[model samples]
Target: MLSLVDSGSGTVVGRAEGEDIVLDVHTSGSGPALVLLHGAEGREANDAFIAALAERFTVIAPSHPGFGLSPRPDWCDSVEDLAYLYLEWLERQDWHDTMLVGLQFGGWVAAEMAVRDCSRLGRLTLVDPVGIKVGGREDRDISDVFAISRSELDARHYADPAAGPGDLSQASRDDVLHIARNEEALALYGWEPYLHNPRLQRWLHRIHVPTLVTWGAQDGVVSPDYGRAYADAIPGARFELVGEAGHRAQIEQPDTLAKLIAEHSA
Candidate 1:
């Protein structure tokens, strides 16, 4: 069983035998429960987006273990572990009919969770998610984010690179540290598989809840076609595109993304 304790720092510490997983969870607003799973960059970039979602439903956003202030447990390594951890957390909270939204890497985690069990989830939304290989061995469906230059990455990640977050040189010390931590954790979970699970596509059919897979119209990282394929694999899943946005739609076009999510969950 997982036990949660308030850490007095706006974060929740979850404990389970021999493992202490500290999750930095941010909660706001009131109504139906809506959980937002952030991208590899962590939750710092989604403040405006979360606030918008909060207007319609109570928003619960948590930094994945190893991101932000959450420390990665030695025994917990894979995305599947993260998925099960969140599932247990949800069960403990007794939240029913919850709307689960995931961005980028978090979307992958959410997908893994839904495939295993979505009884507590009423709806699912994936924005520019990366998981499951839809191509042959020689094909690269997702961009190599880790190997690319910052400028090249920004070019691929944003419809208009200038509109996205500026270079890391200009970021605050705290922001830089947060980003570094996120990158390290992301590499640990996704590097070996190159950001995809060879088996996830096979189990996507197990997700019974309504799912919406959204991609940026100009996404260079995963392409709109990849998004469509992802949506098609899941029974009854719908695919939509956000105009003038790239991989990180929540950051590049928060208002449009928020509107889409609100409508979908409604």
Candidate 2:
């Protein structure tokens, strides 16, 4: 069965294996499960939004392969590949009626998973997702985050510059290396499609589960319009905006975002 071990600290730690890949999974709280897919930066420990959600529902956050403590497997080189890996993991766990939440790149992965199958899955939430192109002509789609300086990128990611991961001058060597590694892994999975699956939009209609697409009202990475298009493509999907936040709502406005997620899933 699922070998989850509760550490008495309100968090449970475990590992899952599928397709020759292993995932370091962290879970907390006590009701239904909510699987959180981390963004390109990897997973965070004790994140505010995650803690908030833990109060009402069990939260399960897994680091994408090659992110955080998860090692990358050679066979996993695309977002689609990651999607399949996660699907296999979910099936292996025999989890049912679970809520799935994806943020940024994780959101893209979640979308892919839902499009493939919704069996045993309950609700879906995509936050500041970047998986489909919504730009035309002179307009730009998602911002080229890798193309900008770290400081500038942070500026666009948060409404308050100070709240961002400021200058890394004093950043620990390990922290610096971790950031580099995250970018490299992101490129491995998203470089070819440039962070989007060209055909995902067309396949979105296949998802018949309740879906919520949330965007930070001040998001500069992917505009609110792009988020709206994502919701519109999926029948009956609802799009909501979180104010005073940018790309990372969980970082800027965790509690509020958690409320939005909890209500939608409920």
Measured by lDDT, the strongest candidate is: 1
lDDT of 1 at 128: 95
lDDT string for model 2 (130-222, tens) is 899878745668788879998888888887767676788877766666677777888888886688998999999988899999998998888
lDDT of 1 by residue, 1-266 (tens): 11222355535445665655667788998888999999886898789889888889999999888887766677778999889999988888888989999999999999999999999999999999998898888999999989988888888889999855569899787877877788888899999798888999999999999999999998888989989999999999999989999998888888898899889987
Estimated TM-score for each candidate: 0.94, 0.90
lDDT of 2: 0.81
Local accuracy by lDDT, each model:
0.87, 0.81
Clashing pairs in 1: none
Error of 2 at 111 (Å): 0.2
Off by more than 4 A, model 1: 1-13
Instruction: Please name the candidate that would achieve the greatest TM-score relative to the true structure.
Output: 1
